[model samples]
Target: MNMLIFKRFSLTILILGTLVACKETNKNPQKKISETITSETQNDFLGNYVAKEYHQRTEGYDWISVAVRNKGDNTIGISVRSRADKKRPTCTFDSKAFKVNDSLYRACSNGVGILFSFKKDSLKILTEIPEQADALQFYCSGGGNFTGDYGRIEGELDSSQIDPTLFTKTLELQGIGFSVSSFARNNKKILQILPYGLEIDNSAITRTLEGSIADVEIEDLNSDGFPEILVYLSSDGSGSYGDVIGYSVNNGKSISAIYFPPISENDELKKGYMGHDEFSIIETTLAQRFPIYREGDTNANPTGGIRQIEYQLVDGEASRKFVIKNSTDFPEKN
Candidate 1:
């Protein structure tokens, strides 16, 4: 073929390929609320389930959805939301439910308990404990509670109403609950925390996350009955440096922020402290453990020992913070 003819043919093929790719992607431009790219109609309960009450004489309506993550384990993350009038138009209930028995999952927050049972085609959520059911008044207004049945929503729940999230989990202690989630926007990761069933206005917290959430723990560090929420974060990379973002509940009235001082801030603590921090709540104290590296040791091989630092929850001038209570070191295992 001539050069002109050959070039035209090649250009035509390229145009066709681009169109096909664009069509494939843009076919379902609707962004849905999901933790992963799984089957939209999967038989499992890891998809979006929604419920709405519509009647001829209905004034204000309730549109709620229960989004279950596709994690294979029985322990799953859930996000529940309800739309109402301009007064309160947000999540009526948001908590992570843990597997209780063979077929029951329960989430307790702010003295209220919610049981989630999955059916073949829908999800049933309600309060089992009669006493906790009374606490539902704080979550919803107009004499309503989040006790109903929701059917699977195939895929789309008005994507405009839901923000796609990477992960979500919740923990509650002493009637205080925290819902944590991570998402990406503008090429940056963002961490969001939603506290529900509080006496004060349930304000949502959002901040930039340098890494991903490794784990979450809740405990009453101060022994004041109100619990503190700790979010363990691991920086993305081979090093996998760890940190924490914590918050404390305020006398069962509201929530306060908790500060975790960086190890570099203290010369002694910073000694041989090369990330890899693991955090947990032991009794009423916050404990952080890491491998102590010697001068010539590598990140993977620390010849010195394991160092653990215990922190006590103390009141700071601005907010509550974790203070080093004691430091102990142990020899490395053979």
Candidate 2:
């Protein structure tokens, strides 16, 4: 009876030990997963991708490139470079990436979705732009509206792909008294501008657009002594229409981006005006002129006269001063 009792106690001790060991293993499963995730991310998506077509617009050829850099602590960084001006700007932040397929992974930030497809030695990328502001949409509409299909470049990524003379021309145009190399070293990238059409008034079709910088002007839109840089940019990637942006210099150094007011396509008189208007800074107001399209007007005979739209800065926000619809307000042809 003494031996039997001793054997029974031993068996109970063995069972309890096994149960405690299994509980510990279950509690620490996440540690193993965390290690695996970090290892996989590092191996999969860190690299440089260059544009395949190089020219997003029709007239000028500017090579654009994108870089995906790991920021540690599970953060990823994305930057885009325009070879024409050597401007590489930060477009997104704190992006979490997930795998879509064996070769494709997607990461979205700031209303833009970037899909990266990896090959053995290169990467093919696709950029998607959504149509709605509150909902999610992509730019791949079988119409070639979004940019993509770039490959990986050899060596480290930098402004070496940009034309050496681009810096000189940019400084000359902006009237900045600085060396090109110094500016390049200080400013790794410039602001990248993109455009999208807004659907309004139950309009089923919205125009697709690509954007480019048309020209730059300096002015004081807020009546401050310091000049506000005005960027004369064209929407729709073509010279079809123009818009002026008001930017203030920050701390007398970096340029600040001017967030334009939302322009809709169905704003009565302002309908069909975006991407078809020319804007200029007149004193402290932004003056825009676009052809007026009456009801049932066609592109060939949009002969519904023209309209002039003016905007003023109120507390650093763009407010429409007034719109003048006239029978005649045409400007010189480009």
Candidate 3:
């Protein structure tokens, strides 16, 4: 009878041990599922994506790509490329994974970033550009965290868009010492206008004028009949506010820069506002406007006033015709 009791006790102990081990495994299954979800989501998010809405070379990018590189931990790298010229990628935004959802992951740096939703094969961008060093506000009104959606592109990814061949053009200029003279070449024939700087053959120069080339338009802002190369540069600080300068070509090879007064809030004249700059060839003048901001104000609630700083070609140079206070229209010639 004593032997039977001892066997029964041993069996009871074995059963209890098995039950405890199973309970422990069940308790931690959720953690394992979370890690698996992260890995899978990242893998799916790694690929090429293009903009849903059509954008020209002047407005923004035609395609944006996300590259997942193994930097010990997984990293999401984003590059915004231009449609007109291939040598144009805005900036390489490198950041680690921010948050992992069931099917999406977010990675951000500065105030600008992109979110990858794997379930939908879509990318959402939150852009908060900085103001230029010459602007008054820390950030511009038109540049804080605007949302943009993009769709996935199939295949092995268009390597062409990733590594675009930089194009070079030849031109000439006269005024040798002006600030915009940086865009003018005294000798070199091939001119490469890159996002970071201007290069004339092997002699590469960075930040020669303002910053990288944000937008390039061939409109005659100086009303010279011939198309002038209006190169819009990226802002210095953190807003979408960029500076614009014009260059007109003589014959097919000679070119010169269009000089205008500094139209920014930080200007000595204090004529412009603290906002993003927009330029257009309206009629015979260059129409310029920027959203107005007050002291200690956020971009969300600007003063609802727009600063109009129009320019016209006077004596073959861009001259500020008039600086309006809060209206889009420049003062009548009267």
Best-fitting candidate, scored by TM-score = 1
Task: Tell me the tens digit of each residue's lDDT in model 2 across 1-334.
Answer: 2323423433344334323323422332211212212224445667777665454434445455666665322334444444545343212112234454455545543334455556654665444332322222221122232234567666664444443221111111122211111122232423332211212121211122235343344455565444455555455433256655444544344445565553453365456453465555555566665665557866544544555566665444443122332223443222
Q: State every prediction's TM-score relative to the real structure.
A: 0.53, 0.34, 0.39
On residues 289-308, what C-alpha lDDT tens digit does candidate 3 reach at each position?
55566676676555535445
- Write one digit per residue (lDDT tens) for candidate 1, span 1-334: 4333433443344334323323422333222212222332322667777775422114555566777763223346567765544346444554556554444555555444467777666777766554445566665567766677888866556654443565566666666788888878999999999998678857999999998776677788888878888998888885678888998888777887899988888999889888777665666777787778889888878776667788998999999999999987776654
Give the best candidate by lDDT. Answer: 1
lDDT of each: 0.67, 0.42, 0.41
Distance from true location, Cα of 160 in model 2, Å: 16
> At residue 244, what lDDT does model 2 achieve?
52
After TM-score superposition, the amount by which residue 172's alpha carbon in candidate 1 deviates from its true location, in angstroms, is 1.7
Supply candidate 2's per-residue lDDT for 96: 31
Candidate ordering by lDDT (highest first): 1, 2, 3
Q: Where is the poorest 10-residue window by lDDT in model 2? A: 165-174
